[model samples]
Target: MPLLRLIMLALAYLLPLCVWADSIVMVAPRETALTRNFVEALSSRLPTDTFEVRLLSSTPAPDSASLLITLGQEALHWRLRQPIVTPTIATYVTLDGLQQLHDEVRPASVQILLASAKPERQIILAQLLIPRLDTIGLMFSEQQRWQTRFWQAAAIQRGVNLYSRGIPGQDQLPRVLTNVLNQSEVLIGLDDPALYNAENLKTLLLTSYARNRVLIGPSAPFIAAGSLSTTYSSPENMADSVIDMLQETWRPAAIRYPDRFSVLSNQQVARSLGLPPPDDAELMRRIHAQEQSR
Candidate 1:
């Protein structure tokens, strides 16, 4: 049956294509440079032949989509309010931001890619930058106090002490920061906008600089504004991370930080503190080696 064999071969090829073909819908709160860059980066990398990616403009997401991706917190909130049942991957949200919405009813299947790096990674970076770094300072808002335990555990494992202060309100920041800096060699900025916003970051940097202690762990933008160093993921890095997750046969619903990142340093700040820190490339290599060893 030559005809039957031809039909079977055609079906075999078509079946795999049908099974692999996935439609991905990306939704963002609004059109912005950040969203545009991410979309462009993702589009360039995703295999056009197998994946169909579209930007969602309105609600009632297409039912044919194999997956939905929300670009930011606002988009994610909007999607959560809807009744769509497609599995979603929410990006550009910090751990605390996502936690704030955890109590709200959401879709059954959702995952998050955190905007911040792991606390352990931050601690390790600090340790690498500051030799014999024993005591590390952390100032967190009341909403982020629960995260201190994770930071403390990471510090303890590395034989370093974490001196953390919780700020009940913005008014208490000056006092809390003073106390934390007095006890610790360096301050590690947590990923809380309430504590680390533009209005507050300048003061934090000035205060830490006055104390001759460097600040670490804020994102790349802060590095330009006097933060000593940080590990950050760019749009391309995030797109690659999403690609990795998509390729996985089974991606469980979990909150994860980007596995790939680039290290940045403020040579001026390092010089001002009289600290000779490794260059960005070396620091990244060391961090990678440490992660691999773990």
Candidate 2:
């Protein structure tokens, strides 16, 4: 079995190299740290001759490139407008963003790497920390109603209850937050600026802290601010996932999140809330194991 598995893995990697071993072009709306970091890390992992960076505003993608990687919404939008025959992989985009892009380009050959954590991944993170997790709370903008439905089903599968509230607007946040906070043991943060922007994040974090409710953030900044932990992937991880998909001989799934992830924790926040936080390495190990089991 071990020998067979090794052969299969070898074939998977080699097949694509044989068929489509050509330069990759990565496009983004603008130059940013994330884009720079992804290109650097991906270059190290892939062949030195295999990748080049192109900005949506400045340079056109080279015709010689076999694969196209787009970062962020602007780049994805730009790609959809063009007639692209090459295989495209989009990263650093939300689930909603992917859906929106697909609406514009159906029968889309472009694959996606969503920024949001999968429901199972988020639930596992919560369950690992709070073993007795019963009622989970979430706040979402009207645009994210689909997420609430997803979590509701996921929670039931895991023997957990989900309490969710939709934010009609930013003005009603305090009232809606108080209502959900009262019913939930942990509050999940979605990656929506309308609901969790810079202007309201401090209020949300402080309120969660005062309520003694565990706040699960969607990104590193949230974990840094006051969230006990956040489930996200870094740019390098995004690059790695994209590279893996491109190394496939055939077109893969149209939409998916990066297989790699990071679980970041703030020990001070955890300690203040009277919770013990797992070390970063240990937490990542557990998360990857959970994903593999699924």
Candidate 3:
């Protein structure tokens, strides 16, 4: 009937307008596959037409626009008045060159040590990595005024023995690590970039193993390769956190460690560097289900 046809035509045009009712403003690190995927997944999950994703080298302070989703590794920060936050999307702010997680875990009386070529981001990590650690060590390239005070304050609060050995260079770290091992239970944190770029990964890992130290790094691949363990935040969970934060507009100035992924012991890596992992019945079942569900 002509009357029925007219009604259908009007509904078609109205449907699209109704679909998009909200919007979120996203600011993340420059350009990368992960960033692209984050935009796609987040946009799809949002209740908006255009979830306007803006790419910037750094995430600036929040504006009066829509919700602010920042990804500043560790080099950037913002001044924000705390507001109610309903974290539905896993939005991450990569400030100071470090990406964070939706959750955090604080270990017991753990010793946290750091070695980085740079100061800003490295110092921030050291502080975040501090409360969880019982002892904190500083081996950085620049010991500017702020660096000294930061380390000093952390030491007083935690009563951690703050040891500062000059930044160690390549082929020279194994010996330095050997010396430090005599005092601490764990050697968690990155070796100075001056040393990392100066030496090969194989050498660094081998040295870490030789010292029987539990090495922890921010880079995921390094953890899989040989580090004792690492705190990780997957893109999936990050997406969830971002949604939650955006739904209620709040950027709580805090850091969170990602989920914990088990590491391959030195013994395990030695067993089969080329073969698939040893079959764990429970693990395999979970893996199979996850795959089949997909």
Candidate 4:
């Protein structure tokens, strides 16, 4: 909640008479540590071709920026229908802003995927795994214990083992990972700092392979390391896309799901794990497709 009263420090760079650049104001409901960090990142990293940015302090009046990015649900509610702006949007994921400007309707599964970030990666992995395989195992344990949700009636209806270490964190992670690999075929890398922080990927995954197990998670960085496969996304891809939509015109108010998680695997990784390595042509095509979509 530290960024709540943030004033537009960068707006001064934007000049009047609609200067050569488009000025954009970013609004978030509260002054969160994460929000402040993002503002810093955006100011330095946002594409210069189309934008200049301002920070709005929850004041209702619209100021400069050609487009305003409202972060989080609170901002979404207040800004979208402001007697001034129309249907901005509500992006619950990234927990970034609540602009009434979102106009894309995404699948429920995709929404869950978007909402699942570094901390709650396990939850997202559970959603994807519980529906596809039984006896899914947590390589390490921490914030989200899968048993709670997976044990529910709906989950029971689906039927799968929601296994865990019972004892989680740095001390027990390696053995726990070993145990989970023994108990199940597929492993979920939940991004718990205690387990994933300093562990090198090649060794951890090779250990799973020795036990004849597979691994999957949301980081593109992992796939290259030796895990059987992984799903990938970058903040910049989504951020730039949203900025472009807001600048051009008004559309539907909805969540735009990431197209698909990138799948990464090598012949050795795939073969030993029982997955046929995806055609290199297909992989290249998919990567190209993502570039074109952007």
Candidate 5:
């Protein structure tokens, strides 16, 4: 029985190695530094003993993968075109972008992690930055018109009036923006690239500045481009959020926004508009308290 005991001990040691771990495939459009960094961050958070993470660029996810994650809109669009059998999570997509894709065709077994901050959070930031703020202006492209209701609801909840204008085409921006600016005290930029891309962002900033109105709520990059303020999540924040979601038991398709975010403000822009910008740390604390209270 000494031989049997040796075999038993060997089996005991090997059995643990034989145990199956869940495999997750993360697909990005291309292997850029940004995508690579995100994958590395996410992988570091997962328990190495229980999870195996793989990053893919243009390769099909193995059928054996327990879960599939699409890193950005391009990767998500590519995945949706295929027959998705694996449970999928899509990140780095704006809520409106996801909605647009969903409208085209309902994706199966997919959960969404919206890249944009919640509308309420943006509205709260705007209110806090602009003293006695009464009315906020918003401009949207034809594709982004649906977002107006969300912004309106958030504005109403914060007891501020919303003045929204729709631009059917870029040609209509000058006219539409003038009307929106004329009626509202401050303009809020949405995450829609069609309405707020580099080509037109300068115009928007210059026009708003000339009118002595502040622009808020665009992505973090726009803060340097003269947007007064915005709330944004970092790569680490996104990775932490994804790790938390993975730890939970599987559920039906659900949508989640980043629980952790950072507030960005341009003091120069605020000063230009004659509004005092609150300290970012203090502003973040107030925002957290407001969110918790609700």
Candidate 6:
């Protein structure tokens, strides 16, 4: 009888241990290089027993997962369509995309690791690059008015002026660009393609140079195309954000930009503007120090 009782107690203990091993479901829409890199970085940070990656189309997740980490917007869309009660953490999604989803879903446990850097981060980096900077210009479509307002408020709090314009259509680009660049020392680009499409980016960069205005943007390509600098997060930084999210209690569904960032600068562009360019290492250190001081 004592042997029977011992066997039942052992079964009860092992059951929860087995269940805990399969508590996480990591989903990605496709098997692309970016997805692979994110998964690799994330795996290195999280323990093997903590989570498992699965292809969104092929794998059926367990009935209940403690956490659902979606790699991109498509995976997030797929997961939201299902009857999932588990908390979701989305990576590589833009703030605009995440906000649209939030408006539609009004989900409680959904969170995002936004692709773009926060406005404060951009403002600080721009100030570092151009110490005399007082006014920053931004061009966005009417759909992004909310974002513009958010940036404007953030800039005002830091004692900087935000000269932002809402373009109604592509036809107003030249006129609006000329007007804003005239008053602003730096032009910061958002993730909006309406303002920075392939056809318009060259002209925009050229216009900023003509006005002696430094252009700080979100993508590395902007630096390659003669912008002074860009602020973006790396895959490793994203892994750290995810780890932080998992350790906390779920919050309201919202887009959260990365706390850590990498800044890229074009030395040739800086030289052409007669501005001294700081080395990447020194620039990063200064930014980190400023962030810590704040």
Best by TM-score: 2
> Which consecutive 10 residues in model 3 have the weakest lDDT in total?
106-115
| N/CA/C clash count, model 5 | 0
List the global CA lDDT of all models.
Answer: 0.78, 0.77, 0.41, 0.47, 0.77, 0.77
lDDT per residue (tens digit) for residues 1-294 in model 1: 366544543343334323443677788777888888888898887666534444556554676565678888877787778765556778898777877886777544677888886788888899899878999999999888877888888888788988888999888889999999999999998888789988998779889999999899578889988899998888888888887766554344577887777898999889989988549999988987898898
Ranking by TM-score: 2, 6, 1, 5, 3, 4
99-175: candidate 4 lDDT, tens digit per residue:
12246332211111133233222333333422456676664444444423433333344355656564444556567
TM-score of 3: 0.50
Of 1 and 6, which scores higher on TM-score? 6
TM-score winner, 2 or 3: 2
Which ranges of candidate 1 are over 4 A from the true structure?
1-21, 49-60, 106-108
- TM-scores, all candidates, are 0.87, 0.89, 0.50, 0.49, 0.84, 0.87
Candidate 2 global lDDT: 0.77
Steric clashes per prediction: 0, 0, 34, 27, 0, 0
lDDT of 3 by residue, 1-294 (tens): 366544543342334322322444665657678778766776777756646766554544233332345454321222122231211122343222221222333121111111121222223233332235454444443322224554556456434565544443444655666665555534444433444332456765676566554444534456567753333345554565444433332223434332211211233643433323333343324333433463
Which run of 10 residues does model 6 get worst, by summed lDDT?
12-21
**Candidate 2 — which pairs collide?**
none
Off by over 4 Å in 3: 1-21, 28-30, 48-50, 56-64, 73-172, 195-200, 247-267, 270-294
Winner by lDDT: 1
lDDT of 6 by residue, 1-294 (tens): 366544543343334322332466789988998878888888887678877888878866665566678888888888778775556687888866765674457466577788876787788888888887789999898877768877887798667999998899889998999999997989999878667778998889889899888888757678887788877878887887777765554565766887767888899999999989757767777877877797
Winner of 2 and 4 under TM-score: 2
Distance from true location, Cα of 26 in model 5, Å? 1.1
- Of the two candidates 1 and 2, the one with more favorable lDDT, higher being better, is 1
